[model samples]
Target: MPKAYVFTRYGGPETEAFVDVDRPSPGPGQLLVAVHAAGVNPVDWKQRTGYRRPGESDERVFPVVFGNEVSGVVEDIGDGVEGFAVGDAVFGTALAGGYTEYTLVPAAIAAHKPAELSHTAAATLPVAAATAYDGVRQLDLPSGATLLVTGAGGGVGAAAVQIARAFGLRVVGVASEGKKAFVESLGAEHVASGPGWAERARASAPDAVYDLVGGQVLAEAAELLTDRTKLITAGAPEEEVRRLGGARVARARNAAVLEEVARLVLKGDLDPHLTETFPLDRAGDALRTVEEGHARGKTVIEVTR
Candidate 1:
């Protein structure tokens, strides 16, 4: 049996608990990984609340684990799996949850963890950084074009800023005053998020916008773009974005996206900046850090040595 932090049922913190379960073996086209580090994302909490991502099925068994991205060494390989072998270092989105000592990763979504990347850094890529890469590449803003990112202080926002900068796009980032230097470090002009953020972003004259904060923030960011197609959001609902004449950032979740972000990390163009880490027993605290919106860039759980 292996220990895991999980939510017994769909609810809030009350539903989350620590439990033991049989170590999962990889099925066809999957790889079983000895977990080292796992990235904590907002979605982890959302999922605990019974909120499911689009395209995710309703069929799920509970005491579901609490992480999405994980990095570790391969322990076992499933039937038909290729390009991976036991003892190989790897990281990717988990097939179920990541807050455990061992978990299965579908071969199509996992990639080798490069020698240049540590488990902590590799853990951040599959979700936050990958989403940034996908959206920035999807927008494909022209060189010298300006891009605005709301909620620019968080994990996904910071990554978007750096990735957009690496591609030669001018970036304007909106965050709280406390994160000005952090956001600026990513090569984006920092705009304080508050009453007049829309005006501040307007001053930057963005040609495109990436909204990482939903609700009013998404609506406000919508004001900065004349071309709705040039506006995209990772935080808002499809109806909300559609009402504003824009669309959500369509994600291409695969090994290719993970590999691209890893390349960015190795090139020194993308740093996940994991500011905090918790051990397996304190996995709840790691999730709480991101859930409380107190984390700067990324938070992770170190599940093993």
Candidate 2:
């Protein structure tokens, strides 16, 4: 039996626990991975609290693992899988959960981890970086155009700012005052989040807005863009964005997107700096940090340790 940190039911941290279970076998189009590192996102904890995606079902699987993106060695190849080997270093969206020592990945979404990129960094890509890359491309802002990204200090927002800059777009990032330096380091003009952020962004005269913070921010950021087609959000509900004449972040959840993000990392265009790393035993604490919205960039669990 292998040990994994899982939530016994859909609830709070009290529903979570460490349990031993049989190692999962790869299914068709899947690969079993020896987990090395896993990224912690707000969604991980949100799902545990019974939050479901827009199209997701109301299904319950007890003792479910919590992680969504991970990096590790390929241990076994499933039927019909190609371009992957038994020992390949890979990273992708986890099919089961990533808190364990081993998990499964759908080959359609996984990519080979380049030798130059660390597993920890690779783990952060499948979700945050990939989403950022997709949303920026979806916006299709022209060169020299100014792009505004709200929630620009977190994992996905940081990647969005960098990738937008790499593509020749000027970026203005909104985050807490404490993260002004960090956001500016990613090549975006820092706009302190809180009162009057819209006015500060107006001072920059942005052509597009990529929002990672939802609610009223999405509505206000929408006002920044007259075209409305250029406004998108990964954090807000589709209906909310649509109400503002904007749209949700459209995802291309395939291996090609993963490869594109990896290339960006290798080309010095993007970085997934794991500001915090915790051992498997402290997985709960790791989730708490992100769940409480205290994570500056990204936090990951190193299961191999």
Candidate 3:
């Protein structure tokens, strides 16, 4: 039997209960992974708390397994699958069911775990890294362009800072005073502040801005965009992005960009910060970390091994 976290009710993380289940088998084109670690994201908790969109309600329901990113070794390969064999180490997103000892992922979404990253580090990539990559690509900003990222100390913001910098764009990261050092460690010029942060960011760059924070910060940042077309938000305030005539790229696909991100990680160009690790039984504590919105980067649950 394999242990897994299962949510039986829509409430807080406390509502998530750990249970035992038989190991899952891979279906055609699926790979059964012996999960080593699973990344925890805001979406996981949001779903558990019944905060998902109506369209997603059916899929993100109670008794549903939560978790998107997992890093593990392949234990079995279903028929019709090729290019992967037993014992291959890999990481990727499974729309659900990753918070278990075993998970089955479609072959297309799986990638070889970067040689340089541990299972904990690789588990942090799927949702956060993919969101950052897709957001950067959507902007299509030119090299040397000034890009401002909000929530720079958080997972997606941290990833965005590194990705933008790697692409040759100058990055100014906005984070709280406590996280300034962490954000700077990721190669961003850090601006530390609380409310009225946009005004401070304008004082520094006074150029094009990217609103990774969303909500009021997004609304304020949009007003300061040298070119409205240059502003982009990965979260919150979708209407504000539209009102300012800036582009909002939500519905950021997790599976669309993992291959390139994996390549970058493999090449030593991308380093995902896996800041905290919780055991499977402490999954609720992990969700609380994400819910508190103070995580330095990614928080993960070590499922097995």
The CA lDDT at 170 in model 2 is 93
Query: Which residue pairs show collisions in model 2?
Result: none
Ordered by TM-score, highest first, the candidates read: 1, 2, 3
Q: What is the lDDT of residue 259 in candidate 2?
A: 93
Best by TM-score: 1
What is the C-alpha lDDT profile of model 2 across 143-190, one tens digit per residue? 999999999999999999999999999999999999999998999999
Range of the 10 consecutive residues with the lowest summed lDDT in candidate 2: 52-61
Model 1 stretches with alpha carbons more than 4 Å out: none
As a whole number from 0 to 100, the lDDT of residue 174 in candidate 2 is 96
TM of each candidate vs. truth:
0.98, 0.97, 0.89
Model 1 lowest lDDT segment of ten: 51-60
C-alpha lDDT of residue 290 in model 1: 93
Give the per-residue Cα lDDT of candidate 3 at 93: 77
Q: What are the lDDT scores of the predictions, listed in order? A: 0.91, 0.91, 0.80
